[model samples]
Target chain A: MADVAYLPGLPRMLPALLPADDNSSPWRFPQYFADHFSEVMGWLWAHTWLSVVPVIAGLIIALPIGWLASRHKWAYPPMMTVSGLLYTIPSIALFVLVPPLLGLDPLSPLQVPIALTVYSVALLVRVVADGLGSVSEETLQAATAIGYTPVGRFFTVELPIAVPVITAGLRVAVVANVSIVAVAGTIGMVNLGLLFDQGFKLSTDTPYYPPIVLGLLLCVLLALVLDLLVILLGRMLTPWRKAVRS
Target chain B: MIGNVLRWLNDPDNWNGTQFTTGIWAQLQTHLLYSVIAVLAALVIGLPLGLAIGHTGRATSLISGLNAVRALPTVGVLVLLVVIIAPHFHGRTSKGYIIPTLIVLILLAVPPILSNTYAGVQNVDPAVRDAAYGMGMTGPQVLWRVELPNSLPLIFSGLRSATLQVIATATIAAYVTLGGLGRFIYDGLAQQDYPQMISGGVLVAALALIADLVLALVQRYTVSRGLTKRFSKSTVGGAVAADLEEAGVEHT
Candidate 1:
């Protein structure tokens, strides 16, 4: 209600004012940027691969499981519950939990991607199931009526129609993975998180802003770029939706 | 390994701290305190904005923008914030780690709460809104009386997800040298105490599940029976799915 004393306007204004304060901080921009430029880029590349591979792997693994859940009514609840439980496990815990389970070194690069794949699969499984379920019964029936086998109908009809929804889930998976992969850095994995750790340790005596600020900017940039790519892909695959709109 | 963890958890020395200052109990309190405060802060910021956006059908882009904030690595954000903000509070006790940790948790919590609330209120039937208007209700009145009650289920679902996320992320607060159950995990990792680390993980998982269960019960009880029946399970699922989709879009 309007009567409620809420300052909804404040949040919208905070971001604009925040950067101005950065100028007064101890860290100088061009100098700091120049100092850490190459190192920052290296970490960014590591972060990108660590975040991205899991999503691709997760999507591949989730497809069959998602398809099975969508095909069988009774499978949905158990699938969602298991994945949901998987998701609730803390990222750091899973990051640590995996190396022991897989008998890998604690700092193994494989650990982060594997842990992230588990998360992406957890997130994407439900997304895949829901996306497949979103297909209209009549449309599916029509496909079957045209003499399509179950596999043929799924590949030819269901999968194409499900692209938007699946892509939507993929975007979430990718972004979430990016954030999570940074956690691995805290435990000594070389990634963008190394930047954060560097910044944190350096700031122990003074608030050194460059590595932290650069890492933040790069992570946000990566997320935005990946998000845009997914949206673009979604639009390309669902050309009929655009045609219908016109 | 499981037996070793159980033994570590049950050890008398593990529970030996003063009333609320040490041991598993104190760590649990620290974890809960961080999560609760962050979630409360998120609700304060997110709920009204979501309701306004839902009612007015405006600033929808804002919701998507907020959703992208969720994608920022929490660990990165936490450390960044600590590096930037911790020095300002350098002389103060506890403020250093607490401030940045709270900021990260609140940031994580806000998106889900905001998005779900917006979706819930917007999804309310237009006919119902028009009917309320026909009865001479003002915009504020209609929002408070009609939209709020109807949107309770989705709002609670958002709160549940946000709470779970905060609890999970709060475990990382210990990485910044704050006290929480994560202290055990971080300490164990540093000391190579596998049993302690595993137990910490077990405790956090248990806490998350328990908290979610409690919230689900609260959600079930608070919503009206008629509204629950009307919304139905599939509608709720659809709402959650749609919210997740929006979350996906925003993160990108």
Candidate 2:
């Protein structure tokens, strides 16, 4: 890590070593930073796109299912159990499972998103179920008493009350996905995991090399950013948690 | 059409017979061994560290550093660190690989173990601790006689998930050329063997299921044998009843 005897960049060190993906013209960095930035950005970009769809799709699937499961004891157990089982399947295995049945090639980029989404299903589902379960019983009874229909109760009363829990779950899902999606490189898209593979490969190629250090820095930075986002997401959604903590 | 050694030996096939198992059965034996070793390794390392991390106030100071370690991408970090570490001890040999696998698995297992242990210890009913302490018990005795027993169920609960996780993840060992059931999953694909791939996937899942069942049974045993919160509550109640009557402060 201390291999670089000198440090110089635009004014100061911000670790802005990666550029956003663009087309039409080659988006390039200074020769020194280019290799480092490209690898970092490659991973960051692939992971972000791979994660976004699953997260959004999961939220859509999770919230309603959680709401329905919350309504009755009969529903909760099976839904939770199945999702739990799905979640427990190792991600790699899950990725492997899809190809034979779905007719999708194992090597396809689709494996990354599909496997991640399957994992997210369980997290989001549990979050939704737990959040709605946590809504005060009295509020539920009052909603019923006030002649609110089941659907009305869900949207107006249940959902509003449960948003914080769902939010918490989504925060967890996003962070977990970020940590997890690094594995996508095993199937071979140049992500953060790929950078590590590259850096490791580079070790015998060049001693005290630049790209390897840059990759490690980017990975740590990526983790920090994702972690901060989860925290910020929690704070944004549930201000009451702040008050409670205080 | 293998595994007819008895028939071959007795009557039909050959004078001397020892049958080789089919691919799936061979893989099953391998899977079971790997899962058991991986889970056992996790529990052995995870439990004590979990206990220390939970019980000691000074250890709480280390959570952030520990969490960062825990948060590291398990495969990537291990792959990177292992390369630097492996020159002296390569991944294939027992001396080189076992320690690293244990290290990675321990890192993976500790977060859940520590979280549960800390949560469990925090949730131990205070009155039970007080009663044990009041009985002229030493601090260590109180922890063992009261807190440890009280937290056993929670610890086991965490272990359930952690053990399953370790079993599932032990597949990553295959990537480092430290082969396990994951070999069927990864190496099978590289070789284009679908049955090997499917068999490996199923074995991992089955191993996970069995691990969970065993842990669940252990949880049941702990709960039934009176090592959990319910038993602690009742015992604490008895002590309280004795103390109150001794003080002559009864008659509600």
- Candidate 2 per-residue C-alpha lDDT over B103-199 given as tens digits, one digit per residue, 9 for 90 to 100: 7766677667666766677677788778887889997777666777788778877777777667766776666556566766766667765555655
* Each prediction's whole-model lDDT (CA): 0.83, 0.64
What tens digits encode model 1's per-residue C-alpha lDDT throughout B190-209?
88887887777778878888
Worst 10 residues of 1 chain B by lDDT: B225-234
Top-scoring candidate (DockQ): 1
Q: In model 2, which runs have C-alpha deviations exceeding 4 angstroms?
A: A1-33, A142-149, A200-217, A238-246, B1-45, B89-98, B134-138, B225-252
Native contacts present in each candidate (fraction): 0.63, 0.20
lDDT of 1 by residue, A1-246 (tens): 574337443453344225545642434445566777787678888888887888999999999999999999899999999998888788887877776577776546787889899999999999999999999989999999999999999988999999989999998888877788788777778888887887788767666666677677778889889888888989998899999999
What is the Å distance of residue B208 in model 1 from its true position? 1.7
Task: Work out how many backbone clashes candidate 1 has.
Answer: 2
